[model samples]
Every structure is written in structure tokens, then in C-alpha cells.
Target: MNYTLNQLRIFLKVVQNQSVTKASEELHLTQPAVSIQLKNFQDQFEIPLTEVVGRKIYVTDFGKEIAEAAEQILQQVSTIDYKTLAYKGQLFGKIKISVVSTGKYVMPYFLADFLKMHPGVELEMDVTNKNKVVKSLQNNEVDFALVSILPEKMKVEKIDLMQNKLFLVGNMEEDFTKKKKIEAILENRPLLFRESGSGTRQTMERFIVQQDLKINKRMELTSNEAVKQAILAGLGYSIMPLIGIRREIQNKDLQIIPLKGLPIKTNWSLIWVKGKNHNPAALAYLDYLKKEKEAIIHSKFSWYEMM
Candidate 1:
């Protein structure tokens, strides 16, 4: 069967999503445009690539096999294109990363200077919980991942970009600056928690166990933003990454509570699977980080160091 690269891409996306509408949304193509390409690609193959029943699309077994082949072919083509750019002495290609939600605040600052330097390079970043971030790395779906807490099971290499500090935070109505016993501070203040599978939640769990503290669990939230809003509403207190709450602290909307062992420390690390062969753009970005990360942290995140 003869088919173009674009057709292969569209067909692969369709097969992956099992819906033309979802594929079009992800690819930034109109539904009709994706449908046209999918139909054209299907016409090239003698075997039926898809079957639709009751307005739902399903890829045939043969289509599943074809989609795997298409993925490999696309990867090869992308490598060749990237190598061509390198041969022309231009740093050009895509770098995809998956980051934990709280890491979003830090990841972009580290990327800005590098991206500015390599204008031809493109970036794709997905921010989600720690579970999804690690899953992306395990599946080889991204070049790297950013997390404050490393996965225990994955054999990976990492560059420690900067320190991540977690502190007890709440609305400024209470005098949280005075040093107080952990239990006293926690009394009557319900603990707002991130949903399970979050790196921040895992850290809080570890701290709770270490301190042998009992928490009045009030709400389980999915995102940092949700937890922040809950705290600002005076619904509860939460342990949050200082990086994500810098603006709130600066604006005096929130304050850090003083307690023994209050700020839990971890490094924000850029990690990748141990033996995966990264493409040129990814390798260049890694090298850039190794050389410039410390300088960037010194200039940008010096406030965390002072705390």
C-alpha cells in the first residue's frame, strides 16, 4: 500500500484514540480533515483498517499492527529529519517532557533561556500527577520528566536542578510565624491533601509518618491549584511546595507556619530512563541544563535558599 507520511500520522492518531474527533482535537485538525485523510489512508490498504458500528470507531486487528509499524516509521523519519538539521549545523527538533503539576512553576523558567537560544527547537510539555509523569517515562513517550520525588522502581538517570522545599501553609489570618508544636498548630485546622499518586501527597505522607502526626483530613484535591484555593478560603491547612506558593506568600495572602522540621527538602530533578537513546534536541537540552542549571537557580530561585 502506498501512503504519505501525513496520512500515516493521521491514521495512527485515529487508531490510538479510536475516535476521529479526539484525534482531530489532539492534532489541531478539523474533524472533516482528519476523516478525509483517514479515508484516503484506508483506501490504500486492501485489508479493512477500521470498522464503525453504532457511531463508534474501532481499529481492526490488522489496523492495530499497522499503527505500530506507522509509529516506528514516523520515529525513523523524525530521526532522519533531526539528523539533517544537525548536519546543517542547526539545533532543531522537538523535546517532549512530562512534569508533575507543581514542577510546572519551575520547569518553564529553566527552559526559557535554552529555548530562546535554540529558536528552531520545539517543546511539548505535559503537566500531571507523579503517576502519569513516571508512566510517560516508562512508556518512552517523552524525552524526560521533572519531579521532586523520584520513582523507586525505575532505573533512571537524573540531574538535580534545584532544591524543592515544602512548607506548611495556610491563610494569614492566624499567627503562623510563631514557633509552635506541630500538634498545636494542626489542632482544629483540617489538613487539605492532594489526591493519591501525587508527589506532594507522597511527601506529606512521609512527613506524617516521620512525625507520627494525626491529620484531620478534610478534603482530597486533584491539583495544587485546588488545594491552594481551599487553603485561601480558610477551609484547611496544607503542605505545599514553596515554588508554587511564592506569589501568594509575596502578596501576603498566605504565610508559612513555623514548626520543627517544617520545610521538607528534596531536589527538583530532570530524569530519563537509563538506557534510552535520546534524540539530538533532547541531548542538547540535557547538556544545556547540566551547564546552566546552577546559574539559573542562583539567579531565579535564590529565595527558596534563604528560607
Candidate 2:
């Protein structure tokens, strides 16, 4: 009945990880400290929050529900803290965005200037796969989502940022110039794929379907960086975002093989729930993007088209 917010945080981390060691590591505390706090928290409730079996920890059903509630509680408390601090700065609080993995390369450049201008503003950007990005947006866990492919059922307002182009990318070892045929390039070389729900993978699938081609998915990676590494090692070719691989192309480590009906293009967009009320920082961020997007693109991303 007298558990502190710190206890709640410890308990939540323990439940999320189902491992006291991992929770301790993430909390930057010792295992004994995490265990002590978790035990203190659990003592306040009648039912068991977690159980240890065969030296492994497992969160009980009640623990899962309580963890969810704790997350909401912590989120609200954070909002309150930020709100209290807002009076100190011109435009203060947090700007939270969940972005598709490739978006990591793009979003930060746009945000750097804005953050510098508003010294008190804080940025929380989550770089994840498309599925997690969409889920976070749908759950209202983030103020905005940066994506190329919009979610199907969400009534979201989108601010188009710029073009996102996907090209068949390979290590320099591949002889792309000699064989431009879709079938020839796709033939012997296995295709490295991003896991399902990646925007690039979806785009690649659509391209395959449209061309009536089949790819041998010999290697699959969950992140753009990992895919790039696999390609650099000559594992296989992959359809990759030009933004994520521009440096590699420039360095001649990777080559973009232009093919007929290639370069699946889409617009990177900042999207949010159509009617959701945005906080002051979020609103200011949207306005900044609206006003400075063109200049930012010209100055920061002019090479996108050239690459």
C-alpha cells in the first residue's frame, strides 16, 4: 500500500523483461537493488505479481495488467513533469515520434536544427520496423509516426516530407552493368530481404508481384543496417532505401542497379491521428516542418535525388 513510484518502475521493468538481471541492467542498478524494490512492490499487493520457476522469472497475468497500468502512470507523471517545466522555455516539452527503421537517417537531420533553436525541447524518436511504428501510432503511444507506407485503417493526416526511393542494391562484386534484365539479375543471386512488415520488404514484394517475378529469399534481416551489412558482404542483393545506402553507393562499396519498372518510389510522411490533440511541442514541431521542410530538403537532402 506504500510502494513508491521507483518501486513501480522497478516492478514494471522486471515484469517487462521477466528477468531481474535484464531489468537491473536496463535500470542501471544492481540485481539486488532491483530485486529488493520488486519484492517491496509485490508485498503491497495480495496476489503474486511474478513467479520464479526453474530459475526463470515469469510475470503472472495480474503482473501483466499491473505493468500496463504502471506504464500509463509513468507516462502521465512524465507529462506532468514536462508541463511543470514548460514555463522555463519558449516552447518546451517532448516531441515523440515512432519512425520506420530507415527513417532514422532522415528524421534526425530535420530535428537537429529545431532542437537547437528551442533549447528546452526534448526529442524521443523510436526507430523501429514498420509494424511497430504503426502499432505505436495506433495506440497513441507517440505523437507522430514517420513512415513511407501509411496504415490501412487509420484516419491519419499526413504531411509529405519528400520522396523515398527503393533500388535494387548489390555489392560491387555483382556484375550489374552486364545484365540489366530483371530475370537475369534476379536469377542466380539470392535476394536478401528485410523481415515482413518492413516498408522496404513490402515495396519489394509489390515490385515482384507486378513484374511476375519470384525471389529466392536466402537471407533475411530485421533492420536496414543489418541488410546493408549483408549486402556489403555479398550475401545477396536487396531492395534498399537510397537514403540509407547513399554513402555506400558513393564509396563504391554498393551499386544501385537500375532496372525497368524499378526504383519503387513513395513519399516519406509525418502522420498522426486526424483528430488527436497535439501537445505544444508536438504542434510546434508540425509547424516547423510545414514551414522549413522545403528549405531543409534543399539544404540537407538535396543529394537524395542525385543518389
Candidate 3:
């Protein structure tokens, strides 16, 4: 079977957009051309590549897997293209990155520094939750993902960058310092919990279950901001990353209570799909991150005590 790089690119684009029309617009190709290319790609395979549901197109599970392979292939081709251009002593391209929501807080600053180092390179970022981060990596939607929890079976490389400590926060009026474990303080208080699939929430739940404590999950929030607001309003207590609530903790609007017998630490990692190709921009960005990882970690943690 024979396939062109352009056809693989069109297939990947359609899967990413979930719409042939959108892929056409992005690729500046006619809708008919997009459809034809997709058809050609499907014909090459033993099975259909996509199925239409109403007006929208959905790539089959197997098709999605093939698209991932195509993405890696395209990435390798792009790497070669970049190297050809690099022979002239110039680097210019885009490096796409995705990060879990919590990572957004610090990733931008590091990215800014990376930009300063390589002015010709452009950076694109997508912020979402842990599950989405993993999905994005698997789909090759982004070159790298910064996240706290690494999934179990993915063929990816993870570099442990920093440790984010989980803290229990309550209204300033409540003093849980006398209480050792989170179970004790939460006995009579309402607990605000982040939604499922959240790294912070997962960490908190694992801690609670490991301690054999019964937690009353009175409320659920989708974001750290909402949880902070709920806790500050005295509606409930919450467990969050210390960095996430640094300001409130320092302003005396919220109090951080230590937990005993609780594993309240999470390791943040910079991850990329294993064996996938990397362009100059991607490599440069990764190098910049590794070089500044220590300084970045130091600066972020230094302010935790103040807050």
C-alpha cells in the first residue's frame, strides 16, 4: 500500500478538528479535496477511516490509532524539513504544547523565557485537565504535555520537574492546626472536592482512602478557583495545591492545616510520547526547559512560604 504525506496530514487534520469542513478551511484546501483525500486514505486501509454521524465526522477508534501513527510520521517529516532549513543556521517553527490546568500557572513564565531565547520560534499552548492531557499526548495533538499525574500504560517519557504539596484550606475563622489528620478536621465540616479526573482531587481521594477515613464530599467544583471561592465563603473546606492557594493562605483569608499520615505530595512532570519525532523548535524548547528547570522550581517554591 502507498500513501502520500499530504494525505496523512489531511487525515490527521480532520481527526483533530472532528470536521472535514474545518480541516479544509485550516488547510486552505477545498472541502471536496479534503473529502477525496480522506477517501483515498480510507481506501488504502482494510477498514473505513471515518464514519459520519449526522453532519459531523468521527474517526473510528482504529482510525484514531492510525491517525496517531500518522501524526508521528508527519512529525518526523517535519523534523527533517526543519533540519534542512537549519543547515542555513536558522531556526523557525512552532512547537505545540498542552498542559494540565494547574500547570498553566507556571508554564507560561517558563515559556516566556523560552521565547526570549529563540525569537524565531512560536509557541502554542492548550490548557486542560489531566485526562485530556493524556488524550492529547496519545492523539499527538500536541508535542508535549506538562502534567502532575502520569498515566499507567502510555508509552511516554516523563521528567520529574517539581513536587507540589497538597494543603487543606478552611475559612480563616476555623483553626484546624490542632487537628492532625484531614479526617479529624473534616469530621463535622463540609468538604469541597474538585471534579473527577482532576489530579488534585485524585490525589486527595487516594490520600483519604489510604488513611481509611470516611470523607463527606459535600460539594464538587470543576476548577481550583471555584473551590477556593467555596472554601473562602465558609461553605466547605478544600484540599488544593499549596501553590494554587498561596495568596489566600498568605492574606489570612484561608488557613492551611497540615495532615498526618497523608501522602500530600504530587510530582509534576514534563512528558512527551516515546519514539515520536521532534523538530528543532521542539528540541530547543525541551532544552530550554531542562536548563531552566532548577531556576523555575526555585522561584515558584520560594514564594510559597511568603504566601
Candidate 4:
């Protein structure tokens, strides 16, 4: 009860990151200072907030509840700060965004421009799989989420940012002199796939089912980078987003396999929970995205035409 907002902020960060070291680095405070503040915060309650196991910090059930309360308090504070700045005809606050792994290719470009225009704003981005990204959104842990597929069960508002195409890709050195049907291709070459619960994997599965195709799954990789590497090493072919593999395709390390019903087109979207009150910074960024997203996408990813 006697703790300060700074202490709550530190506790929130520690809980979110599950590491005092990482929280200290993010808060720009000395490790000892962070430890002291956390200890102070914990002392206010009789129940232990967290426990250490194998060098990792794990929050208790009580800690999780406290962390959620702290998050709401921090968000309210940030909203108040943003509103004050807006009233003064200035913009300042933090923007927290979560993105699926494939979106990492283009989200940074958009963020760079936004940061340049509003130098007072701080940004935090979490890049992870679609499942985790959606979980973050469901928990209101981030201001926005960038993804190719929208969740069916969540009531949300979204805008299309750009075109996202999933193409069949393989090593250029692989001999495919003879054109083959989808069935033959699947049977002849092992298919590299993203791990379960990935947006890309879900899309690929739907496509396979719709086409009445069966896959010879060679391996399941956790990240797009890993799948790309596997394909580059001639391990197998994979259906990957064009945005993630533009560099490899340009360098001739990989080539798009042109087949019937190829290049499944989907839109990259910016989404936020419906009816949630967003801070001024989030609202401003949403407006900026609506007005400039097309131009930004065109200028940054014009290479999509080459694919």
C-alpha cells in the first residue's frame, strides 16, 4: 500500500519478463536497485509474490493477480500521461505491440517511421508465434497485434496493412526440370512445416484439406527462420510468406515453385480488441496506419511484384 508507482512498474516488468536482470535492463536501473525495489514491493504483502527455480523467476498465483492489477494501474497511468501530452499539443507515451513471427519482416519499417515522427514515444515489440501473440491480445497485454489471420472468436477491430502471400519455396539447386502436379510434388519431396498452432501452419493445413492433398511431413520447425534454413539446406520444401523470404529469393538461395493454385494471398492486418480504451499514442498510430499504410507497404515491399 505504501509502494510507489515506480515500484509497481518494476514489479510488472519483472513479472512480464520473468527475469530481474531483464527487468533491470529494460527499466535502465542497476540490478541491485531493481532487486531492492522488488524486495520492498514484496515485503508489503505477507504472501510471497514469486519464487526462484533454476535461475528463473516464477510468479505465484498471488503474484499473477497482483501483476494483472499492476498492469491495469500502469496502463491507466500511461493513458493519463498520453492525454496530458495531447492536451498540450504534444505526443508522448509507450506503444506496446505484439506481432506474429512472419510480420517481423515489415512491422519494423512501419514502426521506424512512427518513432521518427514522434521522438517522445517509446515502443516495445514482442515477436512470437501466432498462438502467443493472440494470447497476449486476449490478455490486453499489448496495444496492437500485427498478423495475417484474425482470430474468429475475438471481437476486434482491424485494418489491412498489406498483402501477405504464402508461396511454395525450395532450394534453387534442387532439380525440378520436370513439371509435376501437386500430388506428385507432395509425394516426391518431403514437406517442411511450421510447428502446430502457427498461423502459417494453420493456413497450409486448410489449403491442403481444400485441395484434397496429403503431405509427407519431414520436420516441424518452431520459427520461419528455421524453416527457411531447412529449405536452403535442401531438407525439404515449405510454404512460407513472401515477406519473410524476399532476401533469400533475391540472393538466389531459394526459388518459388510455381504450381497451380500457388501463392495463396492473405492480407496483413493491424488489430486491436473491440471496445477497449486505447491510449492517445495507440489512437494516433491507428490513424497513421489507416492513412499511410498503403503507401508504406508499397514503398517498403514493392519487391512482391518480383515474386
RMSD of each: 4.3, 4.5, 8.2, 4.9
How well does candidate 2 score on lDDT at residue 75? 85
My TM-score estimates for the predictions, one after another, are: 0.76, 0.75, 0.69, 0.75
lDDT: worst 10-residue window of model 1: 176-185
Off by over 4 Å in 2: 1-85, 216-218
Model 1: lDDT to the true structure: 0.91
Give stretches of model 3 more than 4 Å off.
1-88, 305-307
TM-score of 1: 0.76
Q: In lDDT terms, how accurate is model 3?
A: 0.81
Model 4 deviation from native, Cα RMSD in Å: 4.9
In model 4, the clashing pairs are: none
- The order of the candidates by lDDT, greatest first, is 1, 4, 2, 3
Best by lDDT: 1
Query: What Cα-based lDDT does every candidate model obtain?
Result: 0.91, 0.87, 0.81, 0.88
Can you write out model 2's per-residue Cα lDDT over 1-307, one digit (the tens) per residue?
Answer: 7888999899888887889999998889999999889888989899999999999998999989999999999989877766676755477788899999899888988898999998767787888999999999989999999999988988999899999999888898766666477667757668888898988889888888999886654678888899999889978788888999878988999998878887889999999999999988889988999999999999998888665
Error of 2 at 222 (Å): 1.9
Can you write out model 4's per-residue Cα lDDT over 46-137, one digit (the tens) per residue?
Answer: 99999999998999999999999999998898778777877888889779999999999979988889889987688999999999999999
